[model samples]
Target: MTRPVRRTRRALQVAGAVGAALLALSACSSSSGSSGSGSSATSDSSKSSSPKVSGTVTVFAAASLKESFTSLGKEFEKQHPGTKATFNFGGSDTLAASITGGAPADVFAAASPKTMAIVTDKKDAATTPITFVRNQLEIATLPGNPDKVSSLKDLTKSGLKVVLCDKTVPCGAAAQKALDASHLRLTPVSYEQDVKSALTKVELKEADAAVVYRTDVKAAGDKVEGVEFPESAKAINDYPIALLKNAPNAAAAKAFIELVTSAEGQKVLSRAGFLKP
Candidate 1:
């Protein structure tokens, strides 16, 4: 199993992950749900007009989205009394691989369109993936800026012990884009498989800094300090979500997606530092 998958496998809930209930409703004829333009959710068939949702809604989301997604899941549960929202948070690439490998996920929310494409290209998605939110890269340093690191280039200094997400993942790819945009190079002590692991290294003081999503830095609170750079504009990652073609619980999955794209969901994501799509 991929490192991210293993981290949450033991706690995985059944019924796969969450997705668009509306898509399932329009399963036979619907072009409205095929194009993800502007991040607008397709018609909400899981609303009050629809029947109450039951069973579990499994959600496979990116690690950086953990905080906000978790909150939204709880709210989803509260809104639909007997339904449970189970999640498997990890690197977008790993999650995509798992889905394509037949992990039986109902919903997938990836950190980047590239990762989402992995599943879409395989026809694993029931409908076109919708870009829900965007995230920018930020430098995460120990609290109080102990290393006096103020810029992306500063991470290049000798002996800084900076850490980074593996280049195969979204955060790593964005960091690389920012680095290339600034014409700067950094040699991190190690490359983590997910944004959470990279941030954890700095939180534990095992590394001095890491390049991760702004949401991650904010979630860390006092554990780390966030430093924004001008080049991050060149590498913002768009998060996209979709219902799986083989969703075990299509009804609840659609309701979960509806909840994610709802106004309330946007508020939760905004507070977590995600950019408006």
Candidate 2:
């Protein structure tokens, strides 16, 4: 071959090799860039999925949870500056019904598992309910024990104007169980809709005595007196809480549940006479 042709051939070969090397480098750089882009997208997606807990969270809770939950709601708002908590406190059954019936609520804190089951059974709970506390029945009497009531049997006395929660409510159900365990059939002058109503009966001196929760009696303080009974141990009510399936403020709802199950929340509950689960 001619020297010129040979030189040209070698130059062509060198140029081809360089071109291939450049193509390979370009491909590697493109692959690396794509990988980084994919990672960044995933990171952004994760951040969006877990948004900050900021918004209005509506909570439906049992009437008995009024005091402590109200306190917790305030603390939750304080922790998350841009958040607000609205509460609807009533009978667990009533609250469960409201939630299942499509009431706009973010959380539910029932006074009993049976009531919470109503929400879960309807697939309205975002997650499985957890028992946060336990409560037992107690006899609440007028301040100073003016009726001289000392025991559950005393509530059965012929002339005593005893009050009790409605049979459907957790407190009433517990009171019934205690009565059943003792083999005593005591008729109440009235069956209150919720624990607070039963407690109110005693607090207002409308009834001589009322079978209510120990927590209710303690909450009443100077307005009523509490008497512990043995049968109460057998009729403990488990209070369960959960986030709703279609929570309006999901992030805030989750944060609120975390707060209620946290150590700080337990302290408030204990101070209110609730037993930890």
- Candidate 2 residue-wise lDDT, 1-277, digit = tens: 6999999999999999999999999999999999999999999999899668888999999998998899999999999898899999999999899899999999999999999999999999989999999988899999889878888888888888999999999999998999999999988889988999989988888999999888888888899988999999999999999999999988889999999999999999999999989
Lowest summed lDDT window (length 10), candidate 2? 46-55
TM-score for all models, in order of appearance = 0.82, 0.82
Question: Which lDDT value does model 1 have at 200?
Answer: 99
- Per-residue lDDT, model 2, residue 125, is 95
Instruction: Let me know the TM-score candidate 2 reaches against the reference structure.
Output: 0.82
Those runs of model 2 whose alpha carbons end farther than 4 Å from true positions after fitting are 1-50
**Residue range 161-192, candidate 1, lDDT tens digits:** 99999998999999999999999988889999
Candidate 1: regions farther than 4 A off: 1-49
